[model samples]
Target: MSAKVQWFAKDLLIIGAGFAAAMHIGKLPAAIPILQAELGLSLVQSGLLLSCIQCAGICFALLIGSYVSKLGLKRCVLLGLSLLTLASICAGLTQSVLSLFSMRIIEGFGFLLVTLSGPALIRELAPIQSLPAKMGLWAAYMGGGVGIALITAPMLIQSWSWSVVWFSYALITLSFLIGIAWFIPNTTPSSQAVPLKSLIKLTLQHQPAWLLALIFGTYAGQWFASVGFLPTIYEQNHIAPTLAGLLTASVSIANAVGTFICGLLLQRGLQAKLLVILGFVVLIACALLFYTAKDSLPFMLQYVLVFGFSLFGGLVAGSIFAQALHFAPSPMAISTTVGMILQCSALSQFLLPPSIALLVSSTGTWLWVGVLMSVLSILGIVLTQRLFAIQPKTSA
Candidate 1:
């Protein structure tokens, strides 16, 4: 193969690994009903299952990132994929909720390793001119992985069982693990290892990194809360499992499309700040219309609103990931900065969905969920403005 083709192939492999890792997350929403019936789980317990995959990210993303930098990105990615493969298989065998939840927590660690390392590795591999577009593609991994899993898991579950879904994902992750090991070049670690304390200081001291963290956190929380529960929401409305999965998958795939477009726009010299602000505006409008007007509006219109919300939310994510490369204090700190952002993003994902579930349970309404999302979307707009104010003059 040509050298250019080789480079592109390696980048694709890394992104594929990320997508495989995310399938562990997407597989659960489709299985929630089966789990509730088979395991006798409560709605609160189901919410926990959905959010617990972020546990390691909530607590250890920065530490993992610091060590990943010292360990070499290729090695960390391999180790991450291995963990995911193992965890998925183990989760498939579990007969109790506690055992399954424990395995999911391990999956979170694996997810952290791949996601934190993938972008930094891409920055090292891609030409400067192609970096933004590549990062945008990297940003699409979650939505793409989740969308495919949502669509396929239901079919797998109906044909067999939820355990089959888990086992299938394990096999898929293993395939990517082997492909990455064979195709990607070994990444060398830095000559000197930075201490965890220093890595945290370097990442936390950068104002733009913190702003990016908050912006990503708000967007991720709202997006996950809305999209993650979509299957359950549709199920409550008496929608068939197959159709619900398709609708939810459509929303997620729209997010992937938005992120890819955001990348192209960024490469063409569109301002990241403008894209982010536009994303927030669309999110706010969508949240109000979808959550508040559900009974009055046509079902298709409601789906359109949420689909738009996710698509524009992808624009926010792609812009943030692209800009993060510019704001890192040093080459070694790239993963650290991304980790800090992921930590906050994980924090939001951890907190938001369960909170929404509990509120809906208590009040018998989804209205406050819209209010919460609007508040966060406004916060995202303010943070995006402040983040750009401090953008390094040399940034593209």
Candidate 2:
């Protein structure tokens, strides 16, 4: 019982740290207006700023995963949090766009390190029987972080600048770092002798890794492309900033709830492939209903559809996280599998958001947004089906 409690505590600590890292990602959307006013950024530039954290994930997922394997998960997590704390504090003082850009890249590296290590660490600590449930809960960390950040920023920025919010978040990360150090035991890597090339090759060779990574990319890209712009969209629609923040936060919270539900479903023997397919289908339907002819639709209905998009869309993440644990090529390859998924997810985030912005800029309406997302969702569904067909007949 004591061991189980210790594992549960460790899982919570890792999830908390991940939530804080995600807040660093989430903070930019809330501050877009302030950033535009201060730095004279264009819409596309703001999109780039919002996805700046993906830079590190795109460039270094495999590299960082290899490092985590060598350095030990606990050490890597500590190092990552330290990077976040320092970069966030420095970002609070930056006056130049170039400086802020640099800080964001550093922050990206920090985010990558913590997130990449988190799941593998949880798997290390938790009992095998509890892994599916634990991973499902772990999957909600990013959504919860984003939701909390969106809700809080409007209130914080009313009395203080976005920079002070950055500073305050740094303090938050520092507190998590201290708690993490005290609670989570330092576990050694499974093997120190494997070469990076071998790990990458092994990860790539795993059938489920490719499917999960691609699914994660598609779901994340579509989700972020929509949610990341919600604040700006609501602002343009003449909603109050606080209200927009509240609305966006509510949608994000729905996503977190979806992931939690997915976890429970997985524990109840819900097939992973079915969850992925269902999530994609729901996202497509919701995207169409939410974004089609936006000006003519009932405002309440549009909000409800967007909320549905987030809620059902969350099942994709929970399913992928739970399935990946079972599908990792080996115990040593779990971090590498996660890193690959994150790599693809980040690539989509970096590419899709800018593409979405361009689409809106050229078309002069969000109507086409649904069209784009529908195509992606269809592709996601096709890929998921292919993934299911290729798996062993007895496998979930």
- Location of the lowest summed lDDT over 10 successive residues in candidate 2: 387-396
Model 1 residue pairs with clashes: none
TM-score of 1: 0.94
Q: Highest lDDT: give the candidate number.
A: 1
lDDT by residue for model 2 over 1-396, one digit each (tens)? 687687788888888898899888878877888889988877878767776778889988977886687788998899899999999999889888887888999999999999989888888777777777778788988888889898877678878899888998899999989988898887876665788788889888888788879888989988877777775667657887667778999998888889889988988888988888899999988888777867777667778888889999889999888777767777677788899899999899778877988998999988898988988889888888887776432222
Any runs in candidate 2 off by more than 4 Å, and if so which? Answer: 36-47, 232-236, 360-367, 390-396
**In the order shown, what is each candidate's alpha-carbon RMSD?**
2.1, 2.5
Off by over 4 Å in 1: 39-43, 229-237, 357-368, 393-396
CA displacement after TM-score superposition, residue 318 of candidate 2 (Å):
0.7
Residue 218 alpha-carbon offset, candidate 1, angstroms: 1.2
> Per model, how many backbone clashes are there?
0, 0
